[model samples]
Target chain A: MSRRFASLGLALALVCGLAPARESAAADTYAVDAVHSAVVFRIKHMNTSHSWGRFNELTGTFALDEASPSQSHFEFQVKTGSVDTGNAKRDQHIKGPDFFNATQFPTISFKSTSVAKGADGYDVTGELTLHGVTKPITVKIVPVGVGKGPTGGSIAGIDTSFTLKRSDFGMNKMVGPVGDDVWVNVSIEGGKK
Target chain B: MSPAGMMLATLVLPFVSAGLVMIGAGWLGRRLGIERADHAAAALAVGVGYVVGHAAIASPTFPPLDVTDRIPWLAGLAAILGILESIWPGPSWTLWENRLLLTALVLSALLGPLFAESSENRPSTVCLVVYGLIALASWTNLSGLADRLSGARLGVPLLTVGFGIAIALVVSGSLALGQLSAVLAAAVAAMVLLKLGSPMLLGTVPVMVATFGALLLNSFIYAALPASAAVALVSAPAAFWVSRLGRMERLATWKVVLVTEFATLIPVGIALALAFSASPGYAE
Candidate 1:
């Protein structure tokens, strides 16, 4: 009877010791601050000139799962109406149904599916939902660093990039000869959750 | 074009088509007249078409060839060369020599349509094709120069131990080999395709043949079996082989170009097929 009790106590101690390690494996989550991140694209103008532009007003949540990336999740909402170029007329035209159709599909989103660590970074695979279509996208992410924020909070910074076919998500209409690819640049800052 | 597409266009199709045309163009070129133009016109037309096509594939405009101006004239000039290669059997160049030159020209032409940035699909696809052609071209030149420098030294082995390691890894099922093997094969082919100064078809044939043979061998290894292996399998050996071949080649101007007319024909055919297939109302 004494040996049984002692064995049970030792098992309990082992379980208690492992709890913190498992907890540490959980990656922190962060809320993306739109003002800090930039979403931009470039297209060839008339097969001669290259033109660039950006979209403003984005709100999103980034969940980092250090333990199991498959368990991680990312949800982002970009206001379709925020499409902007230096030219107001072009911006307006882009927002119309022929382009972004902001009124029709009001949000562009991404959700994480998996993450695999690599030599200097990690490969993050996810589904990017845009223009009412969802497609698998993978991006290579390098952790810039992690530290405390001005608000007495912890934060993590990461940079990632991937390419998507605009036409795949039904963004086929164009004002001119703009090609179908739209490259995405992701700069994310996550806070401990 | 997305990066994925660029991967396909620049890295994949160029080598595939180059291999295919190299194998078949002798009879086809006879029908098409691929060798007739004076060397200068032939070179300029092929070079310009190749460069322009490359520029278009890389840019975002999806630029269509200029229908009204210089493009047609260039096309006509290229067409004349095409006719010469196909029908004219009267030249000093043997069947093997003709085949080699045609393959190189086709690859060069195709490179124009395939070169693109890695992130965009259209460009990536084009880039993959260009990469494949370049790989084949690189190998051809490497071997040609090596042979000339050695005066037909037969002891050099183009396939290194790395090839066996890759084959073993691939067969054992560790990494994805399809796309990677294709790319590695191109690399091997490129190492041999390095040029010598002479324009003589006979001078270029051996290197082109050996480079292309290596690419085919790599492709055959993968196509014959659906295996999982990291790209390093083929790439590691290709790197080793390229170094060995380069070391053997004597000092000479590296101006050798693997770009050619047949290269244009294949991608244009593929692109046209894609465009037609993607036409409105076509099933996804």
Candidate 2:
């Protein structure tokens, strides 16, 4: 009976010790709230107007280090196959070899190499891989808003917009009517640990 | 690029290059005294035509990044294999041995791109096994594809299948793959047109099989080609055996050609019909 009590005490101590470490890790790195995030883009269509589309699936995490801001980093991965351009037929075409070839190169990912706080937002320089091509690109991430959840965790809202040429990523198809330049907007909400 | 430019690159250029090389092959063979020039000619024609079209379409990215990019290189390799298969005066068993080894290479070349980099994008192991088997069937001579050709028995069928697959891929949603299919088809067409007179020592069977296998598998796996349509297209290679029947052998040359093309067309027709019928849902 005494030995059983001792084992219980040790197990409780181990659980209590692991909790803080787990929470600290969680506090530093926040998993992206995919439901609250949007990756939308628009390209010039028929040399007339902008045609918009978005990816429906996203995942990744971001680390925040307030004491050492330079230590902060972001990693985002978007499923190229989840593109939703409203029209299913066009989406199928875009997903094929003419453009994304999503089956072979499924994810377009970004991992920040450097991050610096700017006047408007955070200037993040990272390697953005799209369509099996990787390139270093910079984007300014501005704080959109913040809120407190019912569970008392803080929520962060981030908004960023950038323009990229599809040709840069080796997506050299339908250039004129589809436009070389594609404007992208990312709005994301993350829960702090 | 403009429609005219795409047409010129994917269609006209391939036709012109293939025609020039084939016409030149006969003259060059006589001068060089290379007995197997027909095989080399056929392989070179497809290789040159595909590379030219690929360069125009994808713009020659060195160390090819995607499966589509790797096809041009595969075409070159398949051409070499075709020439070697024709010229190498090895025993029948030795031919089978070489083909067994080549089958693995061909399988890896086609399926490697899909399985190389990403885990999430991978097909199930069962699917991989099935595709590998399908590839083996298409790549090897087990289906009675002769190592050396005496006639255009294979070419006529191949031409029908090639055009069928091209149109099928186009209707299925991927114009890029369709155009690439057309590039291969045009090259095959030129070879068949030039070699019509003498079926003597034609060497393009292996490369034709390799290319059609690649295009059929690639379009179905990556593009919007449906399973039913793919099944019909896969039947194309075996359809040529119909021409080798006892009845077909006794017919006149022109009658044999007509009969061979018709036999091949059944599968091609089903494939095309399937693609067209399903287009409203996919290409709308």
Candidate 3:
């Protein structure tokens, strides 16, 4: 009877250990590919047309827990001075104190707090810090594809979009000419780290 | 509210609130036997009014405990100090104590904009030092001018005009900054009215605090105008000495007032013109 109990305890311990290994196998870490990833934003201009811009620099990492999506995490930072609206003069003005105040607040960042699997993909709730203010925001993320890369590494594609008010981040300048509601779209190709 | 309505409210609320507070404080002072209550009241009014005005126009996400929010509280503290000085009138504040107070005020103002950002993006040490020097010099010169012109009834009005032009210039560049500038202008206007009733409050600590605080706001937070233009505006009051030219002191009070306003306007007008020419095409 003693021998049977000891064997049972060992088997239970092995099962528990194997379960985490299996879960972690599905949890892959990825480094954002700056060359393929893009963050773009658009806002209404003068109530007639939309003005579009993009950030040239971005750096972040993500952990995708496929089995348990609740354990997934993501964080990203974008250089505010890298804002490019296709107009050099306009870009400089935007970087000035009137808008981003890049010298004072150089980076706009987001860090996920909780992620949950949704019907289509996932809903990620996080704190976005922009223009020196931090606010809770939720992003709807859709998985684009997962495939093997040319470098023999696994790559995952994701698309995310969210809408935020510029004034909420204290970027209230030129609200009449430049719309307050800004829509952001991000397309990322992350490779296994 | 419409965007236009929001902007209007942002500008008007602070002006009205500061004016009311100043007037109310004056009435209360007379009843309470406090001779310098007008100055303290003006400072407190401006501080409170600014917070309210900012909140009215600010986004719902604005943090309640931000470093920028401390401006009003600091101004309030300065007002309290002014009241204490009025009540005690005992031993004079030591030179070190005075210097320390001035340093603290200037540093606090500078930190407002810097601390608004996350730690990784904070300004460099070199930038901070440069800002500190400029702020210190501007505050010292302006306060000195205020001391010299304290006895002159026109002094406060001249300062008010300076602030008004700053608002117009800032508004032309950034609406949010313009709102802040408008609040400062209103606060100064209220203080001017208080000074008219109680001339003794004109050059008190509270008045200096309000003046320096407004200048800091223009220079640091709403840096839409060029640095040179801002410096010129702050230093315009230093030109008050020109009004004290030979034989001008003996002139009638009305003539002195006219000369002082005119002299102060010369630099201020030039500064405004520079600001307009340098401003980036009116917030486009």
Q: Identify the leading candidate in terms of DockQ.
A: 2
DockQ of candidate model 2? 0.39
TM-score of each: 0.39, 0.86, 0.76
Which candidate, 2 or 3, has the higher DockQ? 2
Candidate 1 per-residue lDDT, tens place, A1-193, comes to 9999999999998899888877677766788767767777777665667777777877777765655756566667777778777775566445543356454456788777877776777777888878657788887777788888889888877777677777667665432357666666777776665
Give DockQ per model, in order: 0.01, 0.39, 0.24
Give one digit per residue, the lDDT tens place, for model 3 in A1-193. Answer: 9999999999999999899988667778788898999999999988899989999999898877777898889899999889998876567567765578675678899999999998888899999999878899999889898899999999998899889998887776557777999999999889988
Clashing pairs in 3: none
Which 10 consecutive positions of candidate 2 chain B have the poorest summed lDDT?
B141-150
lDDT of 3 by residue, B1-284 (tens): 57677656566777677788778876897789887666556556666666666556543233423333444455555556655555554454542355357556756554555565354545667866665565556545554555555445444545555464545455334445555555566556656655653343532444344445444443444345666666666666666676557997678766777777777777777777876676555245
Candidate 2 lDDT, tens digit per residue, A15-60? 9999997666542666789898999999998888988999999998
Q: Estimate how well candidate 3 is docked, as a DockQ score.
A: 0.24
What are the per-residue Cα lDDT tens digits for candidate 2 across B1-284? 78898888788888789888777865686588887777677767776777787677667455667677777777777777766765664677865665555556656766776677674656678876787677667655423554333347666667678878889998887887888888888887787777766563335655666666777777777788888999888877687777668777777767776787888888889889998777656434
Displacement of the residue B122 alpha carbon in candidate 3, Å = 5.5
Deviating ranges (above 4 Å) for candidate 1: A63-73, B1-284
What is each predicted model's overall lDDT from 0 to 1?
0.45, 0.77, 0.67
